[model samples]
Target: MEPVFRPPSEANSYLLPVTTGCSHNDCTYCAMYLAKRFRVRPEKEVLEDLAMAKATLGDVRRVFLLDGDAFVLSARKLLRILAAVRETFPGLQRVGAYINAANVAAKTDDELRDIADAGLTIGYLGLESGDPETVTRIRKGASVDEMVEAVRRAQAAGIRMSVMSLLGMGGREHSLRHARATAAALNRMQPRFAAFLTVTPVEGTVLHEELDEGRFELITPEESLRELREIVLHLELAGSIFRANHASNYLPLKGRFPGDRERLLETIDAALDGRISLKPEYLRGL
Candidate 1:
């Protein structure tokens, strides 16, 4: 793949791979950064890339700080990259990154605040499951409390936050608890958004090994939909935008629930009942 570039804050932003790989890629399910060992791009190299991006792209409204766990970059390194991003992209207004809880934990409140003050508006995380057993089973590397703390600490630092949740993370065994605990955790921080990504086991990931050995059961399409159904029903979001539009999901749904939890749940169920075939699993990123 070619070197990717984007300002610190781009929504639907392109990629700026300051790091080549994920620091903690032990999550059994993901393959996005498995092929490369983790390392930060030299600051000079990152600056040069930013310079090139500035020369080419002019319109910039959203940017997602690329790589799996950009926040894992050293606080000083992150500051420089952010400063470079701001300086290079005159049009940049929104900046976000895909962050993991552990990475976020590495920063002090002051450091996080400084980054946010530098114009990094959003930070995204994957709180895959809130249940301890489920989290351990997948080696997600953060406990429920730790996940909540990550969210709280991020929020405290003045950064708007969004997190992803895997609907069938616990599979059939602990689905309900996963949903309830996850919802409970989200309720604590109630970040700017809650994006739902269905847990689809990709080939060549630890998750597949579990699936192959029958240690884990991939939920049926109907079961996955029902889990989402139960989740949205019980969620007590203040007014978070709930999105189930990721292609891996059983249903594509999106809307704002202004404290109308029941209505949101109903919406999910209705969509499930109405769809004829949510598409073949393979065609659907199955």
Candidate 2:
């Protein structure tokens, strides 16, 4: 099985690999599944893993489907996996999976509702950048409008959505535009949860190659904080929980929308003014 990649919040959940790699692995900045081919794991294998989990862990309240984009599984197959996990662990509260805009659009509203009703309660989506040019340049495979609608459709189907954006995805040249546009898009969708991660160029990624060729420029630490500040400044979220405390972030930030907006901006200001220390580059990771 491929190494499990999961949300930071799913620390206590059981990890189940329904898929071996990302369905769409063409994004320029991502190297997560470079070594693996994409394929849906066999049903028997998935169920056997569930059985083993039950035998060892007794019962789990949450399960995180892996490897990269588990929501790529067909509705029937996903529902079957959810049902099996529920049967194996009667205490299972919710199941979560990594999803993309394409997968969201592929599933019907009824199919999504059925999956959610079956216990797969959350879908983690990497929206990356909301600027059309930036999104296209990164090969994220979804336009800004498509992403917004995908999020809306998924939430309408009863799945709580966790939306993520990258702080330096557009580089210094398009930083402000990317930030403002992403905030605007997120405001329109109003996902249940929001997260921001700083872009870290990994080896073997097109992004890294671009950097090597001097075709891409990464923002400085201060600039990254400024971009983050600009993004938060433009957000008009209703009640979504926000977080920028990921390991990749130079400045850890967490709060709910509309409520902690001012405070987060101030914290960023403090970091900008040298009142707070930023995370060292050596400590950042994907």
Q: Give the least accurate 10-residue stretch of model 2, judged by summed lDDT.
A: 1-10
Runs off by more than 4 Å, candidate 2:
none
- What's the residue-level lDDT of 69 in candidate 1? 78
Task: Output candidate 2 Cα RMSD.
Answer: 0.9
Clashes of each: 8, 0
Tens-digit lDDT track of model 2 for 1-286: 6466789999988999888989899999998899999998899999989888888999899999998889988898888888888899898899999988888888899998999899988989999988899999999988889989988988888889999999999998999999999999999989999999999899999999999998889988888998999989999999999999999999999999889999999999999999999999899878
Model 1 lDDT tens row, 1-286: 3334332224367456677767887888878767777788788887777777767876555667667778888788888888878877777786787777888888899999988988777888888887788888888888878888988899888888887889888988787888888777778868778888788888899998888999888887788878887777767777688777777886777777656566667766676787445656776753
Highest lDDT against the true fold, candidate: 2
Model 1, which residues run further than 4 Å from truth? 1-12, 271-277
lDDT of each: 0.77, 0.91
Q: Please provide TM-scores, in order, for all candidate models, with all chains considered together.
A: 0.91, 0.98
- RMSD (CA, Å), each prediction: 2.7, 0.9
Give the top-scoring candidate (TM-score). Answer: 2
Which pairs clash inside model 2?
A: none
